[model samples]
Target chain A: GAGVSQSPSNKVTEKGKDVELRCDPISGHTALYWYRQRLGQGLEFLIYFQGNSAPDKSGLPSDRFSAERTGESVSTLTIQRTQQEDSAVYLCASSLARVPYNEQFFGPGTRLTVL
Target chain B: AQSVAQPEDQVNVAEGNPLTVKCTYSVSGNPYLFWYVQYPNRGLQFLLKYITGDNLVKGSYGFEAEFNKSQTSFHLKKPSALVSDSALYFCAVKRDDKIIFGKGTRLHILP
Candidate 1:
């Protein structure tokens, strides 16, 4: 793909429902990252995946948020028992590799609205 | 933990005038700085980055940033502003293999 792509650009789910957001990073990128942006707030780190290494999950806000990446390719962010507070834009990014500092390309983002 | 700060919530500039969006960072070891811009209802676009070497780095859309190691700052600047340049800008730092982003500053260029 020319750039990172995210599915379900906008989603509206009822409270307590489980929702999954999908992301397809740029082909050949070895690092993938997930972030959340609440209204009028900055982007908060969620998770990171680097090749075959164990993912860094330190940024996950709580047990309800989890994510997985397959072979440095596509990734999925799943929210369990979604709450109205969970409503926000979920962003996915990818980099060539997880070095000291690498340029990350970002997707448009999925607007998750928990009604 | 590493973090970035974009002090201003918003900045307004007139077309053809110089513009600046302030940014400061905290990190361990050297910093890998970056600037990104976001348009309404769109994804973020990378403007430029400063990895190492020269203090000044240039990037897409005629944007540039100056890396001040002493000051721990990397502010985005443009010689002349355009109305089309109105957007949200973010400053980020790469530390310990993790990229941390700032709150972001909304920039408005008045025509």
Candidate 2:
């Protein structure tokens, strides 16, 4: 089975420009999550979606960061008015579900560089 | 509120020797602990998780972790080290609906 996949392995953009990163979760994964990893740093939770329930937006660092998922499939993390601080590798993950402690499968990630 | 800490930024061990990567976590209730590894230029891969039951949990690549409730720690250990095992390791804890990861520890296996 194919693991999670993210598009545009590398993206370089000017500051203040908006960028959208895409993620394709496994075929039947009902839960998806987004995280940011700066250089030599840990993973920072961004957002997550579970089935039909409302998405968890608590981890979004700021209003400029937002994500949307259609059903249990694809998800997109959009960073508006990107800043140099936003430059990092954006990773996406998926799991069977959030309950009972299912380990998440991660994607290769999209490295976003705000120049 | 919930957090995880990997005390050492890096650990170096000789091949064929034993290795240990320490992890500690803080949460309100029973914690769901996990270990993940990231090889260079690759995505993170789940190693093992401690949900309940036995304190010693075995995972991939001959790796294992012990869950110590009293100490509030879940340290990843391996009896024998392999050069291939060198990479960045992350300690994570599941909190409510989200998972919080530690700053990660880099492992170097000297061959």
Best by lDDT: 2
**Scoring each candidate complex against the real one, what DockQ results?**
0.69, 0.77
**Model 1 in CAPRI terms: which quality?**
medium
- The candidate that achieves the highest DockQ relative to the unseen native structure: 2
For model 2, state the Cα shift of residue A1 in Å. Answer: 1.1
Put down candidate 2 lDDT per residue, B2-93, tens digits, no spaces.
Answer: 48999999999999999999999998798899999999999999999999999999999999999999999999999999999999999999
**What overall lDDT, based on C-alpha atoms, would model 2 receive against the true structure?**
0.95
Off by over 4 Å in 2: none
User: How displaced is residue A106 in candidate 1, in Å?
Assistant: 0.8
- Candidate 2, residue B35: Cα displacement in angstroms equals 0.2
What TM-score does structure 1 among the candidates reach? 0.96
- The list of candidate 1 runs beyond 4 A from truth reads A99-101
lDDT of 1 by residue, A8-78 (tens): 89999999999999999999999999999998888898999999999999989999999988897899999
What is candidate 1's local distance difference test score? 0.91
Q: Which TM-score values does chain B get in all models? A: 0.96, 0.98
* lDDT per residue (tens digit) for residues B7-104 in model 1: 99999999999999999999878888889898998898888888889999999888889999999999999999999999999998886767788999
